[model samples]
Target: MRGGGSKNSPLETLGENANLEISGDLISSSTTEKIFEVSTNLGNKIRLAHSSTSNGKVLKEHGYIYNVDAITGLKSITVAFEGELKLTTWYDDILNGQSVNLINNETSKLSGSDCAWFRIEALKETKIDSIKIEYTCDAKDGSFAYTSFDDLGNLDREGAKNKNVTVSLGERNFEQFEYAYDGVEANKYNQKAFVLGNTKLNKYNASVPNVGEYKFTFLNGIIKGGADVKNPDNTNNSHVFMLLPNHSDVVFENVIFDSTVSFHNEFYTNTWAYLNSLTFKNCTFNGGIFDFPAKELTITDCTFNKYINDNGQNDSNPIWVRSGAGQKGEVSLNKVTFTNNTVNAYRPVKFERLGINNNHFELTFLDNTFNMSTFNDTDLKNYGIYLDSGVTYHSFTLIDDGNVINGGNGDKVYAFNGVVDGNFPTKMGTKILDRNGNEKVIVGGKWKSIEEAKLCSSIDEVATDTNINVSSSGTAIDAIKSSFTGDNATKQSTTISLPSGNFSLKDETDRPSLKDKTVVFIGSGVNSTTYLANKSATGTEKGSDYSFDGAKLVVFKDMKISLGTANYNGFVRPQNLVFDNCLIEGMGHYWGDKTTFNNCKFSLSGADYNIYLYSGVDFTFKNCEFNSPTNRFMNAYREETSTEPIKVNITNCKFIGAEDTASAPNAKPVVNIKKYINPIWQITIKNSSLEGALNKEKGFYQAEEGSKGFVSIDGNVVWEAE
Candidate 1:
């Protein structure tokens, strides 16, 4: 009764008087297509599984119904009816065929009807074109609760389920609804066959066409897994879900799918799985796993929550969300939110793609909020956004962003890329919370790009009084090519406007050599920067590498620099430098030998770093501030492989914060001088005040384990020491 009637005479079910006829009022026909009606008590469920090409149109009176919101006057529904509905294709019976006017004759609103309902009339042959489940819902309340279909064929229906409805139509009327049955084949209903929870589902071809105003929710418990053991050999590309739609802009929001239900494989796939030219808005994530094993995907206007469910220990960032394979794609998040649940949730998002390749992926966070419990936590000192360890992104953008660190931690964000765009606040007050209660912590300074960071100034701005201004007596060429580094340039008397931030002589394009140039910095508000120097265009100016003497550049008052790096490698020496009311980054290598800093604050919050230093001349610091989770001043190798000696001088400095047990240093500072075979000679620390936050074994000086060094603190108040 399901398929064709008897193989011998396939037309035996058709009587001699069984000719199909379609009138304006009714449909009359004699055929052997079985019919049935199905209904379910559940609110969100499936109904029929059949092999009838001419399924009937569900009548309004007989359809499984849902209650409506009284105020809205519309049904508050989340019903997915997956039964066969006959289309108005060709009419056939004992005779050849008959034409039918399937169009609704009651009203002349044909265009609106075609646009609203799921109706298709014209067809050549009868085939099951689609096994569709039409889901109707109102997001106003908890009207629809469906979960766990991303894990193919495995549906955990312990949550909310929908009711089902099915009906069969006469062959004559079936021809009227032929458009709804194009190229469809009757097969067993794979109720939840295309879901894979938090795991990956590769090579799925589910067609979604013209899906405007329809929201598809993929939510369920995902299975927890780790990196794949045989990633390279695994043939199936693991994915969380695969959305293959044609000419559809569907809304996918409020969906939760994790690895609790599926098998977790570390090297298996990417987080958020894969996408193809789709727009997702207002989605929330509750996991710390990341993956990038698919071709392409795009996400916009979403919230990612990564707080742990337990205590103070840092949770593992088990999620890997990125794009892999030769599938170029972009994922944009407008106003994306990422919040940690516990103190130890360090890195939330990590991109693994690196260098130049055809398979490119872009992740953007615009006007977003990233909240953390504290910024002072010693164990959780990492950026909210991070790239792959060795990966250098082509371009990354973090614009108009705000972050809150109620506890002790490090930077709010970090990146290694060609271009990074963000508002790098320079002043103490400028980086404060606004009227709306948004905090913009000026951790150090932000530059638009590596080129901008190199130039340090704008196109027309000249380094005068330690501030950027138009070169009144200099030359001006094209508007775009009017930087200070340009040679043989025409001077312009006209002044040009520039964006405001910290400006120093090091940011100038061409200011002679550090040994000869005595660049003066006297700006009111000069923040921190990595390093500023024009690229060695001809290889003769400053050689084809980083070469600067920090001793020669005399920095004046109103300046602050924290931890920063200027060179790609550790081959060049830090130029001669001096600081007055400036905070130099103390975390990195203090490459300058003849360097002097005065009346400046050097804390780990601003100018802290982990770089090594090689001093060869007088290294003096007086009337300065030194407070960091790590040591405020030091000198060492890039790694512990080099045994070079670090020589320096300290005088009349105020050490407020120290490297205590609570705030431990990321790397062991080379405070132990005995470890260095070369040994530091003529070291002096005189007339400096030390108090509030000092390690027991690390005061005036703590040599590396077994290094030879000397420490002296004279004429200063000492609070505590090891």
Candidate 2:
């Protein structure tokens, strides 16, 4: 009744004559080769009994059923015929998940990744070789791809005892699906078998992008788990989370996955445990990760925190990955970005792959930050890769597109690699970031640090001038040009700009107080970015001696501001300043403080750093052209005593490198960021490029701990060399 020895012929059992379960283990186990010739296109099926619970009692009316025990089951069902196969699965008692592999179907529009039920885990294998699968899905029971777990609001409410969410496809389905996790029987459904997401990517109206923060549909669901010995939370006091698959982008927003308690296998395996095309927005991870064998896993603006006094023994990471055996598949990181996420460790993501080598893992870390010194957390950090001794990743491409890393503990990483993976070289280490933040790898693994980065001194705060602003648009014009001759000084006027609206100038003393530098200036009755400038600058030389210094809010239009050498030795900072259409002629700019230069021209002939950065918050240069001559365009450093992170943005700006690579073979980077006393600089150089030669190796100096910074060279920002 079950197999095909004496009871029934294998050929007749696969036909319309026999409606009994065949023993695939019994049939494939023997070398006799009981080949059944049946037309798959004519709706033929080779049913198998459940591996557990019932020996698969539920059988289809007209198909050959085989025993589905993977331990003693048919390892593979090879169809020599090139045609469509409607792959359907049915729950057999408690056969957790069957992680099936459909090989030789590279062009197959197949389905089924890990599933809740054999019912939910169904696929139609459409082959390129004249095989077209039926584009239909038949759900049995709660076998549709969509699933949900719990509701939020209340604090400590655990859901139903049957907590597993499973769906499958078949003519027959289970009513009120009752499933249990018998941890006592460990390998029955191993602790590592927790499936967060296991279906092919689904289509929807609203989806998440690879980078940037998204307005996530918050599923305020929480789960209180049972006890486990390895968890920090065993007493059911915390609310944990496990992402349930919805066949598409389902954001687990604001939910917390408690690492206090081990949620099954926090470290992923190539089973139902892997996520496939899932998005997690604004979520928090205590244990961290649903990594390994992941397909298009997008995590945006999520906070990851993990700490264990395992006494430096556990190879745990916030997003950890390990596979003892070679996983022969593709695991692409469509977008594993962390723009606004806080990660604790120096290197939040740790991966150790010691396998036989058959994987293509291509990853690009763009526009995020890994601050703090984590290189000393483990022994592997000494090699700059933090890889275990026998680890071999031949096809691993870790691109430091733009990430800022602070420092390492053990030694200075000369050829800095991966802020995400200590193996990624010089995203921000040893070298300063490229104007656009791309780590153009030096040919050999050798690197030399830019010596100028160590020359930074702490910032000296200046006093705020209260009565420096002009009262009205017409009056502002008079105050600036009336005394603005060769000296670049105004008549007792510190900073002048048009008032926002219809300003009736009472007096210069009655202007708005810009002492706190908190107000945003906009053009009167025009776009916030555009102001009607009826007048142009009288001359193009001389950097302004009139400082926009202090945290004073000032906006300048059609003016020439100074980038002078004086007051740049950490004396004055160009804080809270905005320049539009300004001509900057001096050298050695200093102390960036929330400054934005738009449509500005930097005409300094030659100096050290065009922008001698000391300390401050941020700087942005857009639509600017620089014909400056210097060792490099910019270099920065922060003292060990400070904690404020520096951020610089140079976008849509063109720079002429001081030396050509061919002419001066030892040419260096244009933008130089320094090695710091911890807190990093979030630097983004996008839509910008250089016209001359630069060292192929040097890009940006590396950057931190809890707080993350944004580092990326996005939107075609490559340096040109001839």
Candidate 3:
């Protein structure tokens, strides 16, 4: 039943490092739950299914660790599980009339409606102690099969009375148990048990569909000759033992995967899928490369050592997100934690988004140790946790809890090889949170809390044509043209990040519309005396708002763009435009959907409107101030082409009218809304102020007669007029 045959089992290939021996009358359990377990007259514990619920009722009869069969003369035992499937002398335990003789060396397999598979190797005569197992297996450096057995089938240990004891020798210190067996004590067997308790047919693969909840746990063993090869497909494949997405959970505790052979460790040779939840606790993964993509993956108190091979890797390879065409949906890895783990890989933790719909990818390190391994002949991609590029869908943020990562030759704990969007005070490294979740940063390995991240004119991320570090004095628009130098068909330089600089278009320039591009313009924060602005315009000739051919996300933060007579709308979008803590002067922004202006200021004197909304579904302005000296603060004439509704919310904002008293009386309302064909505008203005507007008494809003809209002010606005 456990893979059904002997030839399919792995042949013994144990390491010939030394001989082995154990040092006790019995090897006790090290885990707290199983440590106090003492074998009674009852036989082995018939576990229904190994789970977190360890101490409970068994078979509706006993709660003790063992249960007896109550048979005599070549004594037998009943393995009563929670399913009530008892293992006896009949086919109830064996299928094809294969009788189970509980002697030495031979094992019997049992399964039923409750259990999937279980193997009983050697039975005990009342006084034996090793342990039961869950889906997890324990690996041992030496073999457990002793060469000699007594007349009663007992081992050669002292106080050993009963028969059916299969002896094994090995040593290690996991929790409290100490195993330092003498190598010259006895003969040893050669076996390379990659997984314990599980048959070769049941080594969990992610690509396979789940049969049930897969929770494989490994505890306290030396895992040797381990290979974690992650080929695309066709080497070796398994369609069983899978993880149920959002349901499966596995843990490896106090284990070591030691691959001393230098390169036979190719475990999975297929398009590996993903892990729902997995953990490696107090484990050591030495000398091999493992590719693990997980939704919630945690590596705590583990050590990764000697990850070098004979041929060796060119550079450090990070997490694989498919360097080829991938499946649709959000390409993501979330809530990955490394706590108190020591890693000495070529380049520690690199995560690439793989030029797809990358939503959110983050690495949270708390009190871990990371150092570059200088002892590798292979070239290094020393940029740790480097994501080559970001998508136009969501911002890429770095939440550094805390770590001791060496910044060798300007090594970064995490980095982006290309464009990243957000209010980045720390260039490509944006929104790095501290232990308390405040904004933080890293300066030469050590991290420090900052009041805010400041933007500057530097290519802080990986030097790619997709990033533009604009210069005012030496160079200007070349950085802009260089950002679009890649192949336009694949949109290679699609999501470009514009660093802080005073970029001036000395002549009339019409920047080409970006199809499938989302540009994030960075600048110093609103409180900073330093600033990022479009260089003083040469003439008074303004252009239309920047229109994207096909865009997903656009953000401009801590920056200013004085579009005072520039024939180029360089930024803004049709979807997901979020601006924070920024200022705009003498310009109008055109937006369509999901647009938010938080903690910002906008002023466009002698212009038609500060905002010319093309279309909208959800628009918000929180803690903003708009000084529109010419007319309305905004005029929203939605496109009748889209069926999406218009939802505009303004909270804690101030819309000041014309500066001169004479012009204030002639100023238009705060917002001028035109009629739409189908969708109505549900506008809500709360805790806002309208000063010196022409129509402040009417809540400072004027909609056309046929306009389908409801402007709800809630009487919270402080309306004033000259």
Candidate 4:
């Protein structure tokens, strides 16, 4: 029999020979502020029935043979149990004074026994000084099927600061373990820490969705996949851990992701999510893709071992950072490395630019090593790092410092537009081992080195003789300047030739001045002679308005003119300029009159206008090739008051895009005539074989509205659009 007790008296008393089976609600009076106890002398166990009171009160079950229900009120309850305590419902806001500690310690480990599932969901804006919880379940022979600690709904609401919650899980080995914290408000600044130890599991997954700060530390356990051991498959598609978007100031250390993991935005409307100041230290990723967009991302002392999966799909991108829909970000890889990494499917690291504006996207790779000896694929186009062509239109920067590539058949690093400053591998024919640990050799190539092969591909064999070999006395530009202004300065037309070598113009004072000079530069061949500008000098000069200007007739034949890292405005705009059988690479704006190109090739390297004509008249191209990967070939605009109309004539010419697509959908118009008030522009293409689809009519020229321009397409075979 049970009776009421005071603050000092006993609530229930059982005799030595009595057998009791209690089943009902144990209630306390509203005004009673007392301590309840049970006095037993028969060594019999007392059971607390699972019931709820009318008033807001907490009912906690301890010891053995007890089943607890939901608890409510401001007062906290400490339930310390020796045997298993079955928790069926949720308990929230059960504060005992200012702190609470709930401990569940089993006497011995049991096999096939289920551990308690705690859904610790805090109330809205609830405040507690500190809360400590510990759960331990040691299985002797077998493990629990599933164990989860999910923080459902919104926890840590606004103005709920310094909750100071700590959770510890020990010796609880389960087949599946999940810890999820979702919907944390932005203003809530809570310090939460989780310590997990010895919980060897078949599958474990965790997701932290809080905007505030949090920390997690894992120690001394192999948290792997399901029971298959070799092929540990899970129903949740093999994602181990996820740090959701807008999660900042979080640190995860000493965690081993032996299974696959992804940091993707699984359920979010905005494609461009922000994850700032998140760091992973001393982590190991076995096989999977790590694709996320972040700002100031740091990964130190990490190892990635990527391999193919069962479905014959190599979804192993070690590090893949993509630009958000409209946001800007940066990725930093420091002291990270990859080992046993095979490139059977995709590239190792890819920086994608999905956004239009990418001025703020930057990538830095420092002290990293990529071992590509295990790559078995025969695709030579595969690369260790691939910066796509979309970055050509954006302002992106790449810093690759102290990085080493052990072996690879394809390009080590491939970028479209960026300032690359590092000691990269220059020589080709470096032995690359395949998956069978055998060295592969390239056969039937003209050049032994890859650099030489690239140089030989663009060589023109128009002229074989060099008239006057103008070797550089100091600088190439200075020699050209001295040749035109020295005692042998000629008022008549002169031909200055150069031998088969590279001439670099690197200094500020190394700019050649060709004012009021008529010169023709001839070389041995297009590939043999190259004039390379310094990669650091800008195109703009102080005194002169143009890089090269004021020439009656300036001709360049059988040579390559490379504008290395120079802007469009940093070029020589000569009057009556002619190019014959030459390779004009890189980009520059040309403004002149009476210019002619015969059998010349103009190949642009970046996304810049190939030719910009200012007050151009009688410009003609015969059997020339205009090839640009992205930018337009020509942009011709006229002055309003000028009566001299800009005229461009193309005959027997070939206009090709990047990949020689018959209809180059990726290429801009071949000629774009701007609208002017004076309306003075004319374009004519005759007997030309154009390979790009530039306009709606599938023609080669595009004239602006209200511009007095005439586009005459005669006998031109315009290919179909791709």
Top-TM-score structure, candidate number: 3
User: Which model is ahead, 1 or 3, in terms of TM-score?
Assistant: 3
lDDT of 1 by residue, 1-722 (tens): 11112111112121112222222211222233311111222223221221112333222221211110001111111112233222211111112222233222221222211111122222222222222222223222333333223222342222222211011111110011111112234521112111222211122232322323122333111232322222212212222232222221223332333321111221212323232233333334444433333223344434455444242324333233434432333432111123321223344444454323422223333343444443344444244544442232332222223434332233444432232222221211111222353322223212112222110101111233222342333221221133222552332212222223432233345443444333343333344222222232232323323434432443333444433343222213545555554555434343354565544556554343323444335556655556556544454333333344445566555565454655655433223333444444446667555564453345555454544445555633332222
The deviation in Å at residue 251 for candidate 4 is 2.9
Top-down TM-score ranking: 3, 4, 1, 2
Give the lowest summed-lDDT range of ten residues in model 2: 452-461
Report the lDDT of model 2 for residue 176: 22
Q: In angstroms, how far off is 120's CA in candidate 1? A: 34
Q: Regarding lDDT, does 2 or 4 come out ahead?
A: 4
RMSD of each: 22.5, 24.0, 16.7, 25.9
What CA RMSD would candidate 4 show? 25.9
Residue-by-residue lDDT tens digits, candidate 4, 1-722: 00011111111222111122221222222223221112222221121221221121222232111211111111222333332233222122112111222244212221112322222112221112212222232222221111112321122322112221112111222244333323335522132112222112101123334545432222112345512111212213333222232333333333455554444332121324344444554455555544443444566555666544444334344555444411343332111222322233343455554223433234445566666533565544234554444443433334444455555543344322222111111111112222343322111111112331211011122221122457644334555565555564553344567777776434446554567666666665676787653345455532223434676666666678665434444334567667665677766454456777665678777536566654447788765777766636776764435566667888667776544345345555777767765556667788666664443233466666666756777843332111
Off by over 4 Å in 1: 1-216, 219-252, 257-274, 277-286, 292-315, 325-344, 352-363, 366-382, 387-392, 408-722
Better of 1 and 3 by lDDT: 3
Deviation of model 3 at 171, angstroms: 9.0
> Please, what are the lDDT tens digits per residue for candidate 3 over residues 1-722?
21111111211211111111111221233333232222333222211111111222221221122111111111222332222222233211224323343422123333322222232222222211222222111112211111111121222222221211121111222121111112322422122323222112222232343423344443344644333333223111111112122223445555555542111111221133444555766666664433344455677767767464444363333223332121234432454676887777665454443324444445567876677654533333553444444321234454565566664324455544432222223334234456686443343221121122221121223223255555434233454455554444344333233344454323426554456555555554443322223344332223334444355655565666554433223233456666665676655444546887765678776556677665557888866778776656767675455565578888767887655546644455777777765457677887678775343543468777777757878644332221
Off by over 4 Å in 3: 1-38, 41-212, 227-247, 260-274, 316-333, 354-358, 373-385, 390-397, 410-412, 419-431, 441-722
Q: By lDDT, is 1 or 4 better? A: 4
User: lDDT per model, in order?
Assistant: 0.32, 0.36, 0.42, 0.41
- Which 10 residues in a row give candidate 3 its minimum summed lDDT? 13-22
